[model samples]
Target: MPGPLRWLLFAVVLTALPVTAGVLVLGEGEPDTAPPETAAPAYSSTPLGDLDTATVALARAPFCDRIPEEAVAEALDGKVGPTASYDAGQAAELAPGIKDVAHEHGCRIAGPGGTEVRAWVFVPPVTRDRATDLVTEAAGREGCSRATAPAYGDPSVALLCPSGKRTWVSFRGLFGDAWLACSLSAPSRLAEQELLDRTGRWCVAVAQAASVVE
Candidate 1:
């Protein structure tokens, strides 16, 4: 379950309370259908070069800061804001199942105004079905609802959940073998189009920078 402070930090809301029966917990809505197919990334099947564990760990650290300033400006229609990132240790606490992504990475970008945007990354060096399973499990948590958005990669999925004073979007997709999960949130006043754009555009850079294939 997502803690109260985590909800504030991510601007999330709880719509579907968890119904626990034994060890099982289910969300109010079923996971959205698998994301639409897209061009697979090369690294999806190919091995990530000499980028060893230490190197990959360093690359993922401070990932929120990794997205270039220019990319964020373009995503928000030139509305730029300071960005911050967190590793899996912190990312997992932000919400339930965020760490489900392999090599899970995280970031939070202040909305140029009142909204905030966060993105998560998963590297899975596996076939499409394996990637789909990961995506399904990540979004199946309680309080999340499947949403319609451009699939970020092969076998991807997206969802929307409540955020305090905002709407939060959760998107996870398999690009080749890399699975990515991202969330965009903004004050109710912010247009939904902008949030969608942020998730769609920023994810491109994430896909580009991702080094973990499994």
Candidate 2:
């Protein structure tokens, strides 16, 4: 469940956009069909030790500012899973799953904006999923948000850090520019591992989010 404040902001944004009224797909009570592959890629080039400096600066900017660092960390710091770029059918299949998860957790879902997977918001009903076009500042850059488990329960996003457990996830694209990353844990586990494994997973997520054009 996105907070009331977040939901309100989302609603105001949603109203301003043109709504193409139609039914959206929701995932089956079944498991995800994505094959067991490598995790997605991580988009940030800067090291995590130095995240605060760049992130704080970016947070002050228009689109970047909307997201907090904690949220970014959860979404970007994961083990790279499957590597396939979702086709329309796959995206459609996946979109519903994302939505189902969002609704179950109390967030909202929205678009297929850029080039990756269809973008979705897991905020309150009041909050609208503003297109990257609307938030000119957030155009190409990918960002993320976080809510307590009470609000969002578990996130739609998934990351596979080398640690045995799965971390929560959230991500969004900023004004079509550089990407800003924020991961929750210390990098020693995945970051220190061979093959730049964690970074690759983050990239896959970004690529999937960017593919959508909603």
Candidate 3:
């Protein structure tokens, strides 16, 4: 069966697009760990009363589609070609790292010079310290040294290691319970400094929108 996002792609062609404000969707606060994928039992494999609901989506760019093409072009200097915007269900099916934590999300960008970035915001609030430790341990398993990198005023952390000829970098941190993260696989692990800064900017944007963090 075609994926839900694949279906959205097909529909996007047949519809008109809408306008959105910025890169990050602000004002939503966080929340968690999941054991695994488990669907509620089939209820005796029998039919139950069905509930019908209608969904009305305003005419606007998709969450991922809001990633400004020009910004991506300027940042990565590459063609932003065919891309997929995954909805909550789509995120669940496609992004394992995020499906359990975030439902509404966007992809980092992939472009010229063999550069790529991916990001996520966690829900149910993984405290800053816990997020740091969790990300650090994951990075360690990949042979990366984990540490807390500076993010100006915001709390931040990093996981950096060299893999073969390339480098792996993951940057993540939190503001309130809403946490943001980004990973970059670039030519030098040092290049991650830029990514860390970018992720921090996004986090600040979100926090500002919430009006809770200074």
Candidate 4:
């Protein structure tokens, strides 16, 4: 995906793509913690590094077959501080610090707090086209802290916090279409800076995964 026209085409393709049975329906202005049973299943279960023929077709299925670098870049731009680079293979590889960071922050290892969070990726075909959006958790209704978009804003990529506490970051290429909301519980031991660093790096990996050739 490259430019606007291509993006538009990709959007159409996305719209036309079959909505999976596992996808949960999210109303606008919902919180990011909504149950997955209600969200839409946006991507297939293809292996991350191996881009098979079917996987490539899925990646290329966007309406215009455009490179949506602009959309992706914009969403990721303002979210976090500087990030280290990781190719597709590396993106799948978790950083050693992730565990330490999560543990230090009081987040559970695999339980509610510090475990590996499941994620999905939306690869729009063009820059001008709307980038796909999804969240680590489902979207929820607005409350004391923040408000969710009127409808399911994006279904391709999302950022999330599992605790009940409130946190927000501006993702450069991702913020526009991407939505993020975290759980209210504060981390047990990790510093906020460390948590942000870990999450931020993971997001960068997501962006790169969407662009890199598997």
lDDT of each: 0.56, 0.29, 0.46, 0.31
Candidate 2 whole-model C-alpha lDDT, 0 to 1: 0.29
Please report, as a residue range, the 10-residue window in candidate 3 with the lowest summed lDDT.
45-54
* Model 1 bad stretches (over 4 Å): 1-66, 74-82, 87-103, 112-114, 123-127, 211-214
Q: Whose lDDT is greatest here?
A: 1
- Model 3, TM vs. native: 0.47
Arrange candidates by TM-score, descending: 1, 3, 4, 2
lDDT of 4 by residue, 87-206 (tens): 222233222234211110111112233223222322323232433322322223132221222121233222233334433321222333322211212242555554444444433433
Whole-model lDDT, model 3: 0.46
For residue 3, model 4's alpha carbon misses the true position, in angstroms, by: 97
Query: What's each prediction's TM-score?
Result: 0.53, 0.22, 0.47, 0.27
Candidate rank order under lDDT: 1, 3, 4, 2
Best of the two (1, 2) by lDDT = 1
Q: Which stretches of candidate 4 lie over 4 Å from their true place?
A: 1-114, 123-188
Off by over 4 Å in 2: 1-45, 48-82, 89-92, 95-129, 132-165, 176-214
lDDT of 1: 0.56
Clashes of 1: 11
- Please give me the total number of clashing residue pairs in predicted model 3: 4
The CA lDDT at 205 in model 3 is 31
